[model samples]
Target: MGICSIKQMTTRKLLVLSTIHQISVLLLSDALTVSETSPDAPNSDDTTSINHPRNLATEALYINQNFRRMVLKRNEEPFKYDNPRLPFDEGDTDADSCVAYKYRSWYLGRQADGTEVRLICRTEHDGVTTGPNGETQMLTIKAFNEWDSRMASGVDWRSKLDTQKGAVLATELQNNSCKLAKWTLQALLAGSDQIKF
Candidate 1:
């Protein structure tokens, strides 16, 4: 098999594995929800306000459950890559390629803290020519909020700034890097920033 063919196979396998794992997690979560088998308690005659924490909790439970389903669906979609023909075979010449792909989703709501968290994940694939074979490297970036006991105690929200700031900074870096790398190459070859030019 040619170098590009081998690389294509490896990428296809990665995509399939990622998709299957995502689906399995969704199915498992669904099964857990249904198998609990706890009968719902009868509604009480006393009705206060819908804004109560208990009512909010019940609503949040359903929203979160549905959010997970949406996440799985989005992740399964094929992301744009620098090499549009990627995961494609290059007949021979040991091609040199660089590809970057990213996926992002955001949720805005109060969860103990007033600030909302943004979820993001990005993956980069870089392949270089080495003699008769092609060597490709894949790197992934994942970020989520972490609980900080110290911040939870302080009155000022700035105490938790580092954590939130870190996530934002990482996301910005990835976005900028991918844009720069893709554009730089296009400029070198086409003498312009436009991909088609």
Candidate 2:
């Protein structure tokens, strides 16, 4: 019986060792190479630097208010900006009520040298805002890893807003991953004192 008990103890020791080995292997393989927020990702401060083009904002407001078909230009030349214009109408309500708005195409992408490049962008709202008591409704965005390197090199992101808006998102698409794009815009929008209606 003593010998049998000794054998059992040996087996238990082997089992525990195997378990530890397996866990260690898993941890080593699963070790994250990138930082928690992606090395290339834009942080909150990055978003504050982006502001909707004044012309684009005015166009959106005009469209939303006038209901006329007009092509919005980026006004910032070479930045090919074209997006669906919308506006906020408080009607007879106080001018302060004019906080409602919507984003038409705020993200875009492109391809270069077999790798994709993405652009972080967004349009503005002309209507009343919903979040804080007072805040500006602005478009927010971030570049995709696929296109991030190129975009960070100083290219105006909002070059095209209408039909080519998809290009902005497409240029930066890395195997169809949307996490970076979403995070970028969300971070940019986080600064608002109030959310748009």
lDDT of 2 at 95: 43
Compute the lDDT of residue 111 as modeled in candidate 1. Answer: 65
Measured by lDDT, the strongest candidate is 1
Cα misplacement distance, residue 137 of candidate 2 (Å)? 18
Candidate 1 lDDT over 1-197, as tens digits, reads 45578788999999999999998777544331210111221133444644332443344445534543333333343434465553445664575333343343546566676767665434332211123344332222122211222322212225535657664444333433543354355333322212210
> What C-alpha lDDT values do all the predictions have?
0.39, 0.38
State residue 49's C-alpha deviation in candidate 1, in Å: 2.2
lDDT (Cα, tens digit) per residue for candidate 2, span 16-117: 999999987775443312112333433324433422223222333343334311222224332212432233443644443122233434344555655555
Best by TM-score: 2
lDDT of 1 at 96: 33
